[model samples]
Every structure is written in C-alpha cells, then in structure tokens.
Target: MRNSTLLLAIASAMLLQAAPAVAQNNVPIRKIKAVKPTTELTLLDRVESDTHKKIYQYNEYGYITSVMEYNKEAEQWVLNTDNSYRQEYVFNAAGQCTARTAFNVDKAGNKTTEKNKAKVEVIGDTTWERYYKEYPDSTTHISEAYAYDKWGNRVEEILYGYDGYNRMEFIRSYKKREYSGPVDIYADNANYTSIERGRLLYDLTAKGQDDYHYTMNTNDLYVDEFRKVVWQTENDKLYAREYGCNRSLEITVGSIEREMWKSSEREFILNADGTRPVRETIRSYDETGEVMGDNISHSYTWDNLGRLLSNIRYKGTSSEISYKDEYTYADDYAKKLSLREAIAELSCGNQIYPEDEFLQFGRIATSSYNYVADGDKGESTYEWNANGQLIGGTWTETCTQSGPDNDNPTTVTDRGEIRVGYNADGHMAWKIDHSITESDFSKIEYIYNKEGVWTSEVEYSGDSWDGPWTKEGEWGNARARKRLATRAATTPKFIDDLTDGSHSIEKHDGVWNTYGNYNVTDGVVTGGGYQQTLISTASVPANPAYNYTDPLMPLEREEDEDAEVASEEMWYYYWNTDKGDWELDWGPTDAQRVYENDGNIVADIYDRNQTIVSTITYRLDDDGRLIEETYSKGGNITYEYLPGTNYLLESVETAADNSRNVCHYYYSKHNYVDPTGIESIKRNDASTPVWYDLQGRRITTPTSKGIYIVNGKKVMVH
Candidate 1:
C-alpha cells in the first residue's frame, strides 16, 4: 500500500528543491567538550561520574580528522569499550572527504578496523566517485557517476554494483533528459537481479511544467502493471492531482505470451492545494472486462490547517455507509485569546519558558464508526495544557449491540479515562487510568534519578480516588525479584491420583492438563503417557461424528511447495483403558496450531493409538494459491480465481446434505491489486521476531517470556 499523502509530500519537496535558491545567513559552529548528566549542579561541583570527556583532532584546514570518547574508570579516564567505537577521516586536497574508517574495541583492548575509501575522477561535464571496501580485497566494484549539462543541470546519474565474477551491473540509472521551454522530461530505471526471479526491471518517466507534472512507472515483466500520476497547479498553488494503476500478470510459455488476468481501474481525486486526497472511487470487473459491481466512493474532508475533519466510505454506490471517522479540534477563539493575554502578561518583563511557548491547538476529540448488525462506534476526547502537553483524556467504545429483534437495540459500552501530571522539570510525574469495564482505577508514580532519568515506577490500584490505595507492583530493580517469586509460585506440581493410578497437575497458563499413567520425577515426566499436539487445518468438519471415507493422504514434502497457511484450532483425546476407547482429554482448544515446513496437513491424530480421525488435504496452483480442499467425509470445497491473480472469482462448497453453496466476488476497474504483495510469504530470518498475543494484539516488548505468536507460528520463549 502506497500512501498518497506521503507521495504528494515527496513531490512537493522535489518541486521546492528545483526552485531558485535564496541566500541565507551562515550557521554558527560549536564544539562539545563533554556530555554531562542533567542535574541542578554547578559545573565546578560536578564529579567525574557526572560527565564523559570527548577528544577531537583537527587538521590545519580546521577539518576534524579524528574523535575519541572516554569515560571515567577507577578515578581515571579510559576508552569507553562498551558500545563505543573510534572514527577516523581522511580528506583530499580539495577538502573533500576521501576515506573514513571505524575501529571497534573490546574489553580486552583488541581493536578491529573497517574502512571505506572513495576515489574521485572528473572529466569534462562528468564526475565519477568510486567506492571500495578496504577489507578482504580492495575491489573498486561500486561507483556512482553523474553528468551535467552545460547549463549546470544534472542530465544523467548512474549507480553500478559488482556482479561478483566480473563486470559491473546497472543497479540504478537515470539518463536522457530533454528540456523544451518550460517542460522538462526524464527517465529513471532500476534493475533488480536475483537467482530465483532472474532479472526484474522497472522504468519511470516524468514530465514537469510550470503548472503541471506527470509521472508514469512500468514493470517490464508485467507489462500491464503500470502506474500514472498527474498534478495540476493554478496560480502557483496545486489545485488537483490524480493517481491510477493497473495490476496484471504476463507470462511467456514457450513462444506464447499469456495475459492471465488484470484488475479494474481505480482512481483518486486530490483536494485543492494537493495536500490530501478528496475522494477515492473503485469499480469492479470480471476477467472479460465486464462490470461486476457498482462504483464505490470514499470521501474525505480536512480543515484549513490540513487536519482531517471527516472520512466517509460507502459500500458501492449505495447510501449505506461502511466506515466513517470524525475529528474535532479545540478552536475556541475566546479561550485562545484569553490564553494569549495571560501568557503576554506573564512574560512582560521576562522570557517565556521554551516548553510553554506553544499553545495547544490540537485535536480535542475523535469518533469512529464501523458497519455492523446494529452499530459499532468509538469516541475519544483529550485535554491539553497551554504547553501542548496532554493532561487528561477519555475514551468510550460500544463493544457489542443487541440484534435488531426488539424496538430498541441495546449496546454494551466500555469507558476509560486517563489523567497525567508532570514534574517541575516537565517530566511525567504520575499517571492514573480509570476503567469502568474493570471497575477499578490504576495509578503509576514515576521515579527519576538526580540526572533526570527515569529509573523506576510504583503502581497502585484503588476503587476510588478518596479511598485507600493498594500498592500492586514496583518495577525496575525490584521487578526481577517479583518475577522470580511468581515463577516459583507457579512451578508445576504433579500429584499422584491413587484411585486411577495416574498423575495429574493443575492447569498452568490454561494450556496444560492431566496426563494419564504418566510418572513424574523431579518436575519431569518420564513414564509413558498420552501426548497431544495441534495441527493446522484448512477447515473443520461441521459434524464432529465424521468417519474416514478414504485412505489418509501422505503429507507433501516438496521443498518448492513449502509455504505458510492460515491456522486453526486442534482436537486432542486420551485413551481410556477401562472403556478400551478414546476419550476427550482437554478441549478443542483455540490456540492449537501445527508447525510443518511441508505446507500440508495429512491427518489429525486423536489419541495415543494414533487413530486417524479426519484427514484434510489442500491443493494449490503453480503460483502457490489455494485452489481446492478435500475433507475425509466426502465434503469438499473448490475455489476459482481470476487467471494469474489471487482475486477469487467464485467459490463452491458441497455439504454432506447434498446442498451446494456458491459465492462470487467483484472489483472496480483499474483497481491495483498486487497478488504477489498480498499472497507472497517470505521466510522469516529476522533477528528480532515480532510478537503478538492470542487476541492478535502486538506486544512491543513482552514483559514475560512465554508462548507467543512469532512470524505466524506459535513460539515458546524460555
């Protein structure tokens, strides 16, 4: 998804840079001697612990050649080995930086150097700067070259990358510029080379005039995948702009070129001044270019200050609104005037504080509504001080609503409010959160060190503001002890059930259950027991009494077909020795998922006897899109998509009752739907994996190590 606002802003920046330059006053230069702690202490009274020294080496031309950082150790200055690195620079006769290097130092006083050096060459109107790595081998494999016309306008720019074996490949190139009167034209090309995808090329062309600008981008592999944008200005101010794109797949099989499928056209209308989009409309069409659905429109409005005021999206061309958002700002002129007067009087004979200079002319309230059976809505309001700091806020959400069975639909509302207080130095001192849904209020008091750094906080819970407050937690240094105590308290205890001659344990984290006939020794289960695990499935049978109708399909192990699919709950059971049959153990738990690299679910196991309860098989097309799914009990579902695209055209489901259900989808013309972007699953090799809770909420930093969803797979962190 490309952001229209961001693209417009980038275009505006390019326009500003292309305009004539204006002379400005020279900026003052300052050198730092040391980085000191923030405290109310005189410089002479500060000890070595309060500051770290910085050393600088300058050449005769006043250029810094080297910089060194040192921290106080044992009452003496020493190099900051932790995270600190040494930087050195080399300059040519023209005072241009020619080489730069950084050295990493370990606690054992070992230094490893890495260097990047550049060479400059000038010939006529062209200038070349070649960069090379000075480690392993000094190869001039990367270089940037630029050429300017006689009028000092850049005509060409090229970036080259080494191809490993020999020669340099064109990573990016911008060449062939033509200027005629007030119109300028140029082309930009980018080449991406990969072993699997071969070479993919992208080309862009732009035409700019005094009052109009146009740009078009196209991909060579998919000729039909192109985007075009146009901007028009009036009286030197942007009046309107339009953006549209086409998404399609083009493949060459032997000598035949096939156009599998293409999406309909989608267009956007920009508001005056071109700061934001005014409206967006999408039309849908089938593969044969036949209209499928009515045109859909989403309109938006903004205030003079560029703040969004309202957004309404309609389903098709109907009056039924699908989504809406409204915003309100603090625009009380009288109140603003009074605040200005008070500030002026306070600063009559003194300078105003920097933190209090700005007035709170920000959003005060916002409301959002989504289409549902009844109505789903959320509203929030904020309070800010003259310093533009948020002091308080309130939020309310209608979580659920009764169906339209009665005359009056009832709604369940969840409300919450927050109050914040700041310290004398503008740092946050405390915060309080009152939640009606939780029936209690929580408060956190921040603790800052003498250096104005936040080190810890104390949390308290209470029913009301005037009542006694109970300390719930103390974070920072004390949190480790609390975590250890909690872990110790939650240590699983296995108890022997003499009646059944089995071992049982209380549920921990709501996932584990009792294991029949299992022996526990030193917190470890060693004896034979019925084990259970989750397996991913495309669909679950409507009737739990389903019986196998065919031989279980073997799990696919093809490496090229390995991919991720949607997850679902798993079913588990344990063997009952007395009954001589499988019995339900715990549950059809919702969090169960199977992690397999083969991208197929063969059969789901029900008990220790390895009873194949139900087998579900999935079939995918060459492009790795799901096309068919089969169930063990003769029920099946088939999916049909537009050729070469992930956009489903129709789906048919056949139930055991001999009933068939069909569904069809539609889209607007020129709507850019990138199947690759939406369906492609990349392998996760990221060092820092993103964590999400079972409810699908992202956790920026998990407070405790436990089971979490990482890269769409359940992961247990110890």
Candidate 2:
C-alpha cells in the first residue's frame, strides 16, 4: 500500500531529503511507448536506483520481449537477448498482455555470464506461465508461473529444483513436476487502511518423487499496519506463528511439538525509520509453563557518530551474562589508516574474535588493559606509535579472580602474548607476536585494495624468521559463495499468515511440491483434515503464490489482550526523562506497544507492576540515518559509544573473570543458582575487551603482556 495525501508528500520529501544528492537528482526516467490501451505496464523499470541506473523492460501485452540494465558508469544500457525475457502469447489480434517472462541478470555485471528466463502463459481470466529449464546435468530448474486475476491479483506459482548432487557432479537427472494450490493475493490501496488478502503454495519434489509441501498466506496491510502469519505443514501441523510490525519489526514464534504447548518468542527491533533490525530477542518455555532455558536476547549498539559499536546477546542458562566492546584508532576519524596502523593499534596484526570469549574475559593476548584516567597503571605501560598504534606492551590483571580457578572458569582459556605490528588501511599488514611459555613467535602479512579495503593475508607460526604459514581472506570469500548458493536452493520458505483472520481461506486439489516450480493435477481428496490430500492434478494452479496474514496469539503478539494478565515478579525498567517515556529493558510486554495515526510505533514503555523500570529513546542521526536507540536504565543514561573499528566498544565489567556485569540493577538474587553479581562491579579494570571482525571472526587475544609498540609502528609481539 502507498501513503496518501499530505502524509505521502511529507514522506516523499523526507525520503528525497535523506537520499544522496547525486541519487536524488538522478531518478531513472522511464519512457513508455504504448501502442494503445493495454492492461500491462509496457515499460517496466525493473531495477530502480540512484544515478538513473536500473533494468528496463519493454513488453508486448503481458509478455516482456526486451530487458536491459542502464549502466550509469558507462552512460549507456545493455539489452539482454529476447530469449532472456519470458513471454506467452501468440495472439494475431490487438496486443493484450497475454503472458510475462521471468528473467535474471548479473546485478554486478561480473564476467561469469549467466542467462535468466521464465515461462509465461494464460489460462482463463488469470494468466499463468512457467519459468523452466533443465541444466546440462538434467537438473530441473523450473518455477511455476503466476499472474493476477483480471484485477491484477497475483494467484499462483509452482517451484521446482534440482536434487541430491554435489558441485562435482557431471550428470544429474531431474524429477517430475510438483503441484501447489492457488495462492491468496493481498492488496492495500492506502496506508492506515486494512490490508489486502493473498495466498500461495509451494510444491517441493525431487525428480518425480513428491515429498514435501510449503504453503504461504500473506497480507499487505495498508501502509504501516501489522501483518500476522500462521505456517502449517502439508499434514496441517501448526509450524510457526509470526507477527510483522510494518515491514521492519517481525516476531516469530515456534511451535511446541513437545508434551505440552511449548513455544519460542522472537522479536526483531528494526531501525525506527527503516526496515533494518538492530536488535532481536527470543524467549522459549517448556511444558507446564516452566522456562526451559532456550531463551535468547540480542542488542546492537552504535556510536553517536553512526558507527556500529557491538552486539550484546544472551541465551539459555547464560541469559544474565552480558558483553562489552572497546576499539582502537590508527588515525583521526576521517582519513583511513594503513593495515599496519590498524594492526599496530591493537598491538597485533589480528583482532576480530568470537563475542563469547571477549564478553567473558577482556583479553588482548595474555594482557587485559585497564583504563584509569589518561595515563594510569595498565594504560601507560602499553606503548603506541605517533599514529596511536601500539608497539610494545606488558600484560597485567585488573580484577581479582575467585573460586578454585576463578569462581567459574569460562569456556575460553586465556592465552597470553604481546603483539607488535604495522597497521595499513585499518588492517594489520605485518606483525610479530611473542609468547611467554614456549618463547614462541608469530608473524603476519596483509594485502589491501586501492579503496583501503583489506583483501588477503598470511600468518606464519614458529620463529619470527619463518616456519609454518597459513593464508586467509579471499579464499574464505570464495568458499562462502558456494555455501550461500547451495543454502538458497535448500532452505524452506516461511509459510505463516494463513490462519489469521486478516486473510480469506481457500482449498484446491493439487499435489504441492517445492523445488523450482509447481506441477498441478486435478485430483480427488486423498485424505482429510490436517492430512487432506489431493488425489489428482489440474484442479488448481500448478504454482501458487501464497500471501496470507494470520492473527497472532496472545503470547506471541505484543498487542494488548483482553485476557487477564497476572504478574509474579517485579523488575525496574529505565525511563528517559528527557524523552518523557518509559523504555522496555528486555523485550516487548503487553503494556508497551502503541501505534500512531500513520501506523508507526509511537511510544513504548516497560514497567514492573505500575512503576516504570526503564525508558528507551529513538532518534535519527544526521542525513536521515537509521533510527538510533539510547538506553536509560535505573536513571543512568548510556549512549552508543564505540572506540574500535571492528567491534562496538562498551565499558568493561568488573567480575572475577574480567567479564561484564550480568545482573540487572533493579533485580536481586534471592534463589539464583548461578549467582554472578557482576552488575555492581566497577569499570576501571585493566582488562581490554576483545573485538570481532565484520564476519564474526575473533581478532583479539588477551594476555598479561601489554600491546607492543615499536617507535611509531604497532605490532603483535608474541
């Protein structure tokens, strides 16, 4: 649905104002040359973006005959072959959109040329076609086509795919066609209005063997409205329930499937002004309403200056364990630094690491850094170059450890060492590390791009001179691509939003299969109820597009319910005094959600009984940046403060293990099994939290030796 009236104008203006000036000034101008009155949009702006660069398509009736991508960099466009566009219709009469084609293009225009095509056909008032192809290995690559009724309502799509074969396979035979029911289609004319209901089904099969079915129910509520979903298996097993707040926030709930009605609750907290979620929380319970301990909570932090800070997460029995981050600088905020500077700043050539270890022990090699004033204790011992890169350093423990070997030794073991290295382009181009026990040494080398992007690197283990060598970076990227492509072919689609009252219900007799396309057959009922089966084909669309919006259950939906809510425990949430509202600390509660007239979340607050516990304030950064969240818990305000390039930096906790404070300030441990009173711990500990790279790789090592800084160069001195 689209915004209406003054709201639309305001939204457009805001969007335009926030977009890049180069982008805003160069909207792709579409030139349509229609022969006469036609139902289809002749000139389709396939890919719309800034600099007027996008894919454009010319269609005869519903069949697209030409497709091209306008390369703004080249100041021209390249047209795909006619076969690249799928179209159905050989009408000798006046051109009416009889069919449309499905096609794909290399978005990046890489050298590996791949062709894209789809089938298009018409049956009754609803036009239907198929996009099909069999690879050289006989692997099926067919997707059932879809089209709306005369009203332009999308109806069906059949999906088919190749089966059981590795990348090395040379010959793979394809199976028979799969079938699915006609999908429900949704339509919403304006924002603030109700949604349009739609449905679609997926028939998945291997070769001629039919095995699984995926059905979808979708609803497009008018502008910023809630979308609900209920997914069921072919056997009518309730799979999941999901509530989507606008297009951004989504709450997914898993089915019980246990002795009792068990379910897991997940909420996605998105950027206030956009659809990107910055935080996600999941909660689960077992039979008898007892917390089964599979709960998870995740939060993302960003600096006031708009850099990502760190992501904090809690799960299962370790829900109370919190994490922190700290960053180093190789240069001023503007100009990028060399890999040598980047690595040297951390006193090492390597930095990113797993978040779990960093949360438990803020260690860089064997040494954990303590920040006291500007040059106190652990702070001054670590030497840095003129570029703020660490060259030489000594390691020391800030907080005392308890228990037989520290109350409860974490899963991570501390390996101590001092790192010495050269930083180049915010990456460690070269370094040497020295270890305590073995008197061992490790060296590193890096490669980067003209844009200062790190490309590849190598590490040698043994003496600083040379020994066993290992390589990383580009190799990893190649492996990742293959895995991603395979996963896309195998993952099942979410089929919620069907049972909710937001959409209409429909049943058709067709064997549903999922792979690439659907193979429809008119058949009699093979079974009934949850296992109701279609005995024949041709009764429904071979491929159906499912779009249904189901209603969320009380426990799943954050909306207020008429059911009586009884509370047993009391907790304190933060209230942002300046913003004039209470903030939710953990996740959504019944009393927290409220919507504005335009369907945007206006205000949300968390409370323990009638007393407010915390307040959350949301605002946009400069240039209409995504919504930034600030937390105010127990009247103590903390903004997103990150000091590192790889990880979001936060205050280090003062626990025995050099971990963050896990306990909530307002909650007391009365019968706690794992009592870790880390919240009250001080922040001046000499432990330097570890940082994880963009790909979730651990880069920092903690030890007793401070970061090694040699002259103005930083290095990892083992």
Per-residue alpha-carbon lDDT of candidate 2 for residues 285-337, written as tens digits (9 for 90 to 100): 44344555566665555333333344455544364534433333222232233
Query: Which structure among the candidates has the greatest lDDT?
Result: 1
lDDT of 1 by residue, 1-718 (tens): 1111222322221122111110011111111111111222111101111224433322222222333445657877776554333344454565444444444556543455543334445567544444444323434334444443334333444434444444333333223232211111111101111111111112222212212111111122123222222334444233212222333323221111244333454445666555555666666557676766788777767666655567788878676788787777765321232322321222231112211212322334444555543478888777877765668788888855546775555778889998888898896677788987978888887766445645456677777854366555211225444544656444332323333334643222212232334554554434433434442322321111011111111011111111254443433455444653446555442242221226653434333333555545556657656666566666666667655445445556666565665544332221111122212222342233444444333455455555544544455554
Compared with the true structure, model 2 gives a TM-score of: 0.24
Which portions of model 2 miss their true places by more than 4 Å?
Answer: 1-130, 133-282, 286-290, 294-433, 436-438, 443-459, 465-718
Cand. 1 TM to true fold: 0.34
In Å, residue 413's CA in model 1 sits off its true spot by 2.5
For all candidates in order, the CA lDDT equals 0.41, 0.30
* Local lDDT at 360 for model 1: 22
